[model samples]
Target: MTASERMKMAAGEWYTCIDDELEALRVTARDAVFEHNSLPPRQRGNIAPALRTLLGAMGEGARIEAPFHCAYGFNLFLGEGVFLNAGCTILDTAPVRIGKGTLLGPNVQIYCAEHHREATGRLAGLEIAKAVTIGDNAWIGGSAVILAGVSIGEGAIVGAGAVVTRDVPANTTVIGNPARAVTPR
Candidate 1:
């Protein structure tokens, strides 16, 4: 049997992103997100019931501030005590796992989709997804951008405005574009 575009995407295989099925899913997610974002914080609590139902998994005490956005909510998993500040955006075409006690500062962006490099492929809307994992107790500073396939290790600290493109070592601190480990002064 041939795999559907969604299946191919879940398997990290290249697939055309512009598909009816995907569009419908995105629309569903948009509605959920809108509900979550539009409600008062007191009423929304940690997460709106509508948005919570849309997610794959959400541990107790997980909190997402208003203005949170994701490509597909089902691809996101949050562990206990995970806190996402306002304006966080996740292009979760693939799974995005956030471990327990992880804190993401405001405006953090996590991208799981990697568009095809060639112009023709771009025009065709071809892309592949890679899972992004953030280990327990990690702190991602404000405005950080985590690219596709990056694994942020446990207790790691990502400096503000950094662009993380590679795996971060456990308990390390990284800064700057394409994030590099910070050296002790």
Candidate 2:
């Protein structure tokens, strides 16, 4: 049997995001996000339940602050002690795995999806995705953008406002638009 669009998407193959099944899933996720973002901080008791329903896997002590946005929350996995600050956005068209103790500063964006380079394909709504992985104890600074297929290694630090297009080595610090490793002090 041929693979479904969702299956193809998860496999990082080209797929159409406008599929009815996928659109339905996005709707469900959007509803959960809306509810989660609407609640006041005083109503903290209600937040966890919504996140549990939305995310694929949410580990113990994982905390995502309000105003989080994602295409499909079900594709997101958060490990123990992960903290996502406010205004975080993840285009989880494919899996986005955040390892234990990883921290994402405010306005951080993780994108697992990409459109076709060709105009014909782009106009046809053809898209592809790649899973993004962040290793344990890593710190992603505020406003950093992690692109598709990038794996951030353990203990790595991505400086503020950096755009990470490549894999980050363990225990290193990277900075700038096309992030480059900083000389260790």
Candidate 3:
């Protein structure tokens, strides 16, 4: 039998995002996100209940500030002491793993889907999923955008407003558009 769209997506193959099953998953994520975002701060401790249930895995002490959003919550995995500040958005079309003690500043965006380059394919909603992994103790600054298939090494620092398009090496500091590694002055 042919693979379903979800299966194709999970396998990192090209698939149409407009499928009924995908829409259902998105609706589920939306509901969970709404619940997480709507609850009072006192009531939503660390990770909100609904969102905690929706995620694939969440380690102890993982905290997400309110107003966080994800396209599909099930593909997100967070390790211990992971802290995400307010207004973070993750397009988790593929697996997104944030390692232990990692911190994401406000408005950090993680995208795991790359849309087709062709205009006709874009019109058809064709896209391929790619996993994003942020290593332990890494710091992603505010307003940074991490593209699909990027693996951020442990202890790396991503400067504010940086657009990360390539893999970052361990303990490296990256800044500016396309995220080139920077040496200390």
Clashing residue pair totals per candidate (backbone < 3 A): 0, 0, 0
Compute each candidate's TM-score over C-alphas: 0.98, 0.96, 0.99
Q: Give the TM-score of candidate 2.
A: 0.96
List the global CA lDDT of all models.
0.96, 0.91, 0.97
What is the per-residue lDDT of model 3 for residues 52-153, given as tens digits with 9 covering 90 to 100? 999999999999999999999999999999999999999999999999999999999999999999999999999999999999999999999999999999
Cα error of candidate 1 at position 181, Å: 0.3
lDDT of 1 by residue, 26-97 (tens): 999999999999999999999998889999999999999999999989999999999999999999999999
lDDT of 2 by residue, 48-127 (tens): 56666789998888888898888999999999999999999999998999999999999999999899999988887789
Give the clash total for candidate 2: 0
Error of 3 at 96 (Å): 0.4
Select the stronger candidate by lDDT from 1 and 2: 1
Candidate number achieving the greatest TM-score relative to the actual structure:
3
**lDDT at 58, model 3:** 99
> What is the C-alpha RMSD, rounded to one decimal, of candidate 3?
0.6
Worst 10 residues of 3 by lDDT: 176-185
Q: Regarding TM-score, does 1 or 3 come out ahead?
A: 3
